[model samples]
Target chain A: MRWKCTVAYDGTQFEGWQSQPGGNTIQDFIEARLAVMFERRVVIHGSGRTDSGVHAREQVFHFDADWSHGPDKLIRALRTGYPDSIQVYKAEEVDEDFHARFSVVKKRYTYQFFEGFADPFETRYFWSTGNRRMDVERMNTAGKLLSGKNDFSAFTANPGEERDDDPVKDLSLLRAERIGPRVILAAEADGFLYRMVRSLAGCLFDVGIGKLEPEDVLRIRDSRERKNLVLTAPAEGLFLDRVWY
Target chain B: MRWKCTVAYDGTQFEGWQSQPGGNTIQDFIEARLAVMFERRVVIHGSGRTDSGVHAREQVFHFDADWSHGPDKLIRALRTGYPDSIQVYKAEEVDEDFHARFSVVKKRYTYQFFEGFADPFETRYFWSTGNRRMDVERMNTAGKLLSGKNDFSAFTANPGEERDDDPVKDLSLLRAERIGPRVILAAEADGFLYRMVRSLAGCLFDVGIGKLEPEDVLRIRDSRERKNLVLTAPAEGLFLDRVWY
Candidate 1:
């Protein structure tokens, strides 16, 4: 039997979602607890990877196992065993063929930042940009050009990432908005490359600070060169918001 | 010259608000920075004290100093030198007779807790009370009995605090409300005894859980003894919300 689970976590304490030898990652913790509950080595898979210090509102995962208990008991046991920073919100049975990562049709990510001064209580969740003023309207104008299927080679870390990896992805939405002194940038797509969202956010920040013109976004996308853009934003401000299947 | 400053802090990292021999308090950090800026020893007087792990939204402090720079420059310098968890929001010159603690007319405090499941991001600021259902309406009805001038000996730690310490205080407000899964308890008073708010919150929590009747609160107050109430809520969920002069 396969099970689908919805998870939310504050990623500050974890190395990321993927399991590593250090045993400090979210996957490592979840798998360890599942192994304890099932009385055997149990592996749990995640929908996608998030960088260290990045947060999640609704992340999906799935696992295949046979158990004597129901979903409610499993969720209760998981919540009790896991750390406070990790929350397993929902769990239910799924088809055996279902997969957490491959079955996803769309995913959305949001980045948050603030200007002027950072609030003491909010610094953990937002990127504090010091005293610089940003032109959010210009950033939003540039974001419209990011929509559509395109080879985002310029926005990815390296075009030479594995010979079979695809640089072309279907981007459905890319927009920016200002909520008081806080600025939010959201992007949705069928798939993203290595650090693609952070790379694009860095370019948008340049547009906001008048370092690059709005039309420069279009030119960079057409360039198809990784050197066309620089400055990958920090991971602390990013959040994996949602996934659709 | 005496300068009054409005301060806010996430007290998770500090020993408390007052300076101690260990020099780990909030006042120690502020005074250390002020000493560097003024090129002399400096001391700060706070409106009141908070326990370790307690937060503040608008704490007040006063300091006497003389320097070549103006208030704006001083504020900017202090902000740059202070840690991200501490914020000096407002600073201005005040009359010599004005003192942070003595000139205060009122102070307000708020305690926050959440029922059901806890949000991952809010774990630091709110108390997670798992599976317990609190009657917010009953808690509010019991809260009304806390107002007016009364010897809050039943709600405080003990009457042996000082030679002339007064247990009688004028409380203007004590209210409770529910915002979704979160429950907020706010209290306003001309003064507070040591751990008075936490003790009151504990009794209210008893009433909320049907462990005690609302009339039992009046009985406790009339007893005028610390032995009547003994539970003191944790410091992490307490916040010094505002100070009115």
Candidate 2:
């Protein structure tokens, strides 16, 4: 049977979800525990691979095992076995064919920025911008230009990525809003190109800083060029908000 | 010249505030950075000495110096030099006789609890009680017994403490408030004996779990003996909130 687990993590402590060259990864750590829990070999598939220092709000993952344990018991086993930095929020059996990576309709991501030195309470969860003032209106307008299906080759770090062969993606929503000095730019799309969210965030940051106009985003979206459109924001500021099945 | 530096730390990674025979200590790490900044030997005296795996909020520390540099520059230097797990929020000059430990007038502490299981967001900052239901009102009523000057030998845990002769303290306030599923106990006092906060928190936990009545707190407080006290609460839930001069 295959099970779907909604997960959240403080990604700072791990070397990212994917197995690293020679370092510990989130998957490696969780698999170690799953291997013990199931008493057999197990492979877990996540919604997508998040980079190191990247956070997730409701990441989905699926794992298969022959054991007949209920969701609650399996969740308890997973919870007790893994380190505190990784948590399984919810667990449930899914259709055998349900794939966390491929079955997702869209993925929503939000980038967070808080003004002032981060609160001792929030340092791990937010990007502390120190004293950089951002123009929310400008950033939002630029975000509005990105709310449709388009070839987002310009808004990706490496346009030559294997997934970039099909750069046309349906961007369902792109909203940049301000809750005081904190700016949360959230975007959801049927699929994302490699580093698409960070690259788009960098463009919005340029707009917020008056370095680029809102219309420039439209030009970049239409051009489909891989020229001066490759600024990837820091991974710490990005969050995998949720994934729609 | 005198100085005070507000500190934040991940206590899980340190052997408390004092240097001891251990892998790492908060003071040792801090003093190493201070030595680098001053270009000589430098030591910091903390307002409160915490046990292993305990954290702080506005932890006051003072160091005498003869440098021409202002306090702002020193703050920047410390912030730049320290690791991400630790942070210096403020630095400033004070009177020559103003000592960090001896001259501190009051200190605030907070203990955090999470329901069911630990949230990854608060892995370092909160204590999880698994499935145990905690009664906030009972904890609050028990907390009231902690006010005023009293012998808190029962609430401490340092059998090899050097400050064994100084066991009495004046507690200004003790409060238990529920924020969401978390019941936070915030207490303030003129001074705390070693493990005092942890012991008091343990008693509150006992009250929360119905093992003891709220009235039992006064009995324990007036006992002036550590024999009947509850077990020491985990260090992760405890924090040195502030130190007032």
Index of the highest-DockQ prediction: 1
Q: Which stretches in model 1 have alpha-carbon errors above 4 Å?
A: A158-164, B20-23, B158-164, B228-230
Residue A129, model 2, lDDT: 71
| Per-model fnat list | 0.83, 0.47
Alpha-carbon RMSD of each model: 2.5, 2.1
Highest lDDT against the true fold, candidate = 1
lDDT of 1 by residue, A1-245 (tens): 88898889999878888898999888888889888887898888788888778888888999888866888887888887777888888898999888998898999999887887667778777887877778988988888877899999889875344635578989998888899999999999998887889888888988999998989998998888887455788887888999998
Candidate 1 chain B has its poorest 10 consecutive residues by lDDT at B157-166
Which residue pairs of candidate 1 clash? none
Model 1 TM-score is 0.92
Q: Fraction of native contacts in model 2?
A: 0.47
